[model samples]
Target: MTYCKVCSLGSDHPGIVVDEQRVCNVCRLDMVGDLLVNYRYTQEVFERFQHAGRNELGPYDCLFMYSGGKDSTYMLDKFTTEYGKRVLAWTFDVPFESTHAAENIRLAKERIPATFVVDADDDNIKKMMREVFNRPAPRKPGKYLDEKLPCVSCRTFFVIRAILHAHRNRIPYIALCADPQQILTMESNVREIVRGFYTTFGVGLTDELFRGEIEGLLFAEDDELPEIVFPFIAMRHTYDPDAIVAELKAKGLYASSPMETHCTLFPLLNYYSFTHWDCMFYKLNASSHVRAVKRNGGDGARSTFSLKFPGTLDVLEVEGRLKKVTLRIAKGEGTPQEHEAELVAAFRDLGTTETAARFVARSFLDMPAVAADMGIRLS
Candidate 1:
């Protein structure tokens, strides 16, 4: 039930091993080794290599994964306006997006000197998401994450596509706005599992695919594989959502974008630990928002946050509602069928057919037992 003191990763997470001082096993984040390939890469080394490399590689040759949020939005701003990079901003416009998110993407495209692509693979993506959500959760598998998080799956899909895109375009770099918490959250086990996952596709995500391999990218693009660079990592930037918003507005770029909310398969993994069992861990076990804040420049007050359904229109709002229904089911109580219309509406807004939404709602509520029943056999 204890969360990591250094990062948002909960103690119940498969990747963590708590020590005497209550430090979870990923270096207790002493050197940020839990996140970065080499925990030792300083801002100076990052800067020196990037400067020399940029001199040779020139600008305008990187492909960015843009999601019209504070981090990705500001990332686009930096890539086009500051660096003058000819960024091919790729968006995985799945059905779970807010309407305003789509509009934000357009505004970004209109403003930035970059080619914006909307990979509206909603059918396949939703299919994949449905599969993930419908699957049973397992015990915290050591170094093994449940494959039911649609967020992870979708991002993985985009990463593979980005690799292919960069390869086809002969672009030397693949850029993403990975905050510090994301860096830290990429525990060794998760990285190892992901390394194995992408190897099947014949893609190398970075030179040091495993943690502590060494500091290798960003001085220049490595030819053995296209470099995936985290800008904040190179600059050692802290997580500052407020600052990002302020900066974006100063340039008249963004009006507003929905803040992070769990309207997707996030609940399958996050809420699984909570609603199904008597454990203290639940929807906020490994918080993305908290971790993202820590990743940039700010510290997270984990005790201060709770996951909630932002509104009826938030695409993933069904997740929050279904989770409540699931808890009731676990307690053998009747569900709030009166709210079914609103529940279905939440899903339909995200492009899920009403029938599918109803079916999915039932499935989510039914699957927690599967997760709760998982036998813990630690290695």
Candidate 2:
């Protein structure tokens, strides 16, 4: 089976039957277009979204998932400075987040005067990362062969913690600082399929490695205490990146330069341009992107999936437009020579060339067609 050439919906093979139209069952429902239209709202709808979450008696008006990245900083700035809402900035400081991001969050705390919370246990995060990245395939497993993408796992960990925190604190609003593009790209149906695959991995991996931490999060109480809102969904149409960054910088909200290194594993694996992660991490998370790739309608390329498990990316299956690497080479965006230079530079930062090559190739060449469409822009 193959994807719908027009929309990039994938062929589900034995899992889902595609119709004569070559569109997957999911796409046939037209949910993707519906998702886009419903989420792209007018100013009146935006005001209603904000007003629905208004609470005067709540301890904090909102629990903001603050990545210390630009989007969350912008949201935090507005919540405190303009909107006059008492907000708490929460961070799940994954091990791989740049020190620059750390600096930005630190500065945000001082400038916004918002209470900040961070869950930064390096040892535990590293150990969990080892499970997904270095599973028991010493018989010589491929670089990303745990069959579980690590980047999405990190984001899931953050999300679970935030939900738990909100319930515990009775926060009336839970806000995610994702821009419209990020929110728009998120496919509702694809998430359920991907979650099914990961939940299985979590059960086994957590039993062996985390003992209870992972499962505890999965089973955490889900009492509804707050309404979740994506402020950027409304703001993206008019938000100016430069202006936002400028105001944030002037107010001492971010301490790092915009040009910083980003090799967040999932972004590296999902995008042709690993470097673009710095500019777009908050738009979407790796797990959802991978889910889209495994499902159909992922941009304009045919999506392929793993056979052993239903809804997971099959890394070995790289036929479609994986050759777009050649197109990128023709355009001078990057070449073999430049890749070697990047490898050499990466070695200066204590990473090995083999490790870098494996990841970069996965990021750049494996799913070239989808990568190009998703704004990594190989050509």
Candidate 3:
């Protein structure tokens, strides 16, 4: 398959358009004059917000989401040392988080002088995740659902929890460390959206329970809320992931390589998406990494971080083969049962325990129902 020379986005991917110059539509859009102007305006606004909120009476200037990954660690250092902000660093302790990540958190707490808090509501979080996994697939699954539903829902939960904490403590700002490719702006109707999600998922919430738990957690219609900001996008310099990792290691903030810091469930979820939909959940993010490296005058292919499975398997190589298999299956050259067997093999290769694999596999057993809900054929 052909790929854009600039971003390495494949021509075969849905909604991607490549030009004669071997550049992708995203690159073309990036060249637009107004878009650049708007980006500058966003930076200016963020600066103004930071300056104005510096003298607020709250104990902390910002509530920073700290995952102990390279990106978050870098941002925490900047907030505390560079910007001189009084920060409250909050970590959501997910059950499947890597041991390396936990160690990184311990190191960062020792190195960075910030009020550190780790939220561990395992029972409630597990219950919510069970509902997320078992709920019927969406009628109109938006882009990235097959790969990102669990991550996105979990993020939403934590973001809401962060907002509630910030509001109660009178913190004026909430800072997130998502890279430019993954950043999303807070919408005005976020409250409504959160309520809709809980109702739709029936997330262990009766009417009275929702009123007691959700209503109190959410802000009123006219209540002032903490302003949400993406620090990576607002910063002036390009976000070099490699540089960030190197700096973190040099400062004794983190010890592991980037590939070793993700959630344990990440590989399993990516395997599921690739087998079921012929799409790598991380394909776009990987492409974005390549583009960013090239923009910084680095070799895109050589500098790009490749996803690693538990064993010796390289994820990108697997993606190429999966794409071909998907095409063959579409043209009646492959069998669904063969694909199912391949998925089982892939799970085994990931080194998952038999019981864990079976449990997660059962969660997606209604793929046909999910496909029907989305008005598509799985095979």
Winner by TM-score: 3
**Which regions of candidate 1 fall more than 4 Å away from where they truly are?**
1-11, 18-49, 52-60, 144-148, 186-195, 198-224, 235-237, 257-269, 272-326, 329-379
**Range of the 10 consecutive residues with the lowest summed lDDT in candidate 2:** 300-309
Displacement of the residue 108 alpha carbon in candidate 3, Å: 1.4
Worst 10 residues of 1 by lDDT: 303-312
| Clash number for candidate 1 | 10
Collision count of model 3: 0
Error of 3 at 223 (Å): 6.2
lDDT of each: 0.50, 0.49, 0.61
Residue pairs in clash, model 2: 8-297, 9-296, 9-297, 10-296, 182-283
For 39-74, candidate 2 gives per-residue lDDT tens digits of 653333446546655455566877889887777887
Q: Per-residue lDDT for 2-88 in model 3, tens only?
A: 678876665555445678898887667643464455455456546755686463567898889888788899889988998888899
Candidate 1 lDDT over residue span 1-379, tens digit each: 6645544354665555666565565534444542355334333333442553442343446778887766678888877778766777888665555444566677777777788776665554554444444445545543423332444566665565565555555666667665554543332222343454444223333222322221222222346345566676643444555566678778766766333322333334434444323222232223444343555456432211222222222222334565555455545566547435554654455345456556545444544443343321111
Instruction: List residue ranges in candidate 3 displaced over 4 A.
Output: 1-45, 55-57, 136-141, 144-146, 184-213, 216-223, 289-316, 321-379
Instruction: Estimate candidate 2's RMSD in Å.
Output: 11.8
Task: Give me candidate 3's TM-score against the actual structure.
Answer: 0.67
